[model samples]
Target: MQALRIGTWNLASGRDGSGRSADAATLRAAVAGVDVDVLAVQEVDVGQPRSHGADQPAEVAAGLGARDWRFAAAVAGTPDPFRSWTPIEPPVLRGPDQAPSGPHYGIALLSRLPVRRWSVLPLGAGRAKLPLQAPDPRTGRNRWWWFPDEPRLAIAAELGHCTVVATHLSFAPHTALRQLVRLRRWCARLPGPVVLAGDLNLVGPVPARVFGAARLVSAPSYPATAPRVQLDHVLGPAGLDPQRPGAHRLALGDHRLVTVTVHPR
Candidate 1:
């Protein structure tokens, strides 16, 4: 059986100096550090003002020696408020305003394999009504909320005999559930084996149910530092078995890189 290796990470590239623009050395290390046939990335900035209008997806892809790269701009373009920190609501939340041309902060899939087919699945309509709160490590203030306008998206690509879907879901449980429903429907329509990976933003039985019945493998992936929630995941059809399952911690983003190897059953 042919083995397929995949890796995913939510590289938080934005206006904030959160190590979004990974240096060449860091990118090289990240690529060499993980073992995967393809890499799926979230929060990649494209022509974002904060990123100095750099094409981060292309930059990282080139750094990893991956010439074939696919990208979907969840947020096309918007107004930049010069200096503003207020978190806007979804749909209107205005993703990384800096990036007004393409996905304010979109997802990207980079691979050395030839892409046979591709499509994007928008997660929610208008703006997702989800809430996320994180304690400011620097300020000790809790209840910080930021809603991303670009609804989570699923990008599916056909690689030889397998199909790969990469997405980043909402933190809201209901929104995630709705996204999964759409995901399952899409997966059912694809030909050949299918594999899905992303930051689902939920934990426990919910995820298990969505991908579990589909016979996709599930492994904990989240909080790159010290994972308390299994927000990230990798799932494949029942016919495939996980050869190895694990995640990598990096200082560049809040999420870790989940890598998995699968063998046909």
Candidate 2:
């Protein structure tokens, strides 16, 4: 391939900036606007009534024209204000006959390019629910809570020459650091240079160091209305062609989208 385009976004389960529900059309359009070959998405809803029972991963993949994609359910139930999520024993089913069908919520990775193979790495849920800084609906004011240290996972799509990994780490600082460390070690066993895309929950420098990557995309994606921190990232290995990053605010969601393109090694 001459160039590789990658992106990452947290869909906020199809919620608009004001925390209003976004229809499937809005969700698809927001993702399509990025125009990336590979995308890693977080806060996805599958077979959930809150998202109008739509499969978020499938919708975005269709919008992006991605031929290969997978959604790993970190939690297998409707986790809402009235309830909490429980972790799946093994997010990836053991065999072809047993894929997860839900009322579940988790992360997803989609690719327009042909994938040689796909894999998932589970990052277990953090033990405690911690205070997090985020947006307050359309007001864009800072809110310090309303989040859980949810179960996490990394999904990789090997596109022959390079592998693109998608993940959302825990909000707890130490747990997120440990998860990033594990993910970096896991990538070491993959075939070639790897590009990781996701909302790592850690600030820029920490994830870069842990993943052994050069932070290419530097968009401050949190609090999409007026972002102050770059929680979303696109990190690539050495020998990558240099280029500026792209950040886009979507129709809805608490975070912005981050994209970057690089010449193939």
Estimate, for each residue in 96-199, the C-alpha lDDT of model 1 and write its tens digit. Answer: 12333453557888776777877777665324433455445457455645544445677887877788888887666777777888898888788658788887
Cα-based lDDT for every prediction: 0.65, 0.81
10 residues in a row with least lDDT, candidate 2: 93-102
Overall local distance difference test of candidate 2: 0.81
The TM-score of predicted model 1 comes to 0.77
**For model 1, what is the error of residue 49's alpha carbon versus the real structure, in angstroms, after optimal superposition?**
2.8
User: Which residue pairs collide in model 2, if any?
Assistant: none
**Model 2 CA lDDT for position 70:** 87
Winning model by TM-score: 2
Q: Best candidate per lDDT, number?
A: 2
Q: Which ranges in model 1 have alpha carbons more than 4 Å from their true place?
A: 14-29, 78-103, 125-149, 212-220
Estimate TM-scores for all models: 0.77, 0.89
Q: Please estimate how well model 1 matches the true structure, expressed as its whole-model Cα lDDT.
A: 0.65
Question: In angstroms, how far off is 71's CA in candidate 2?
Answer: 0.4
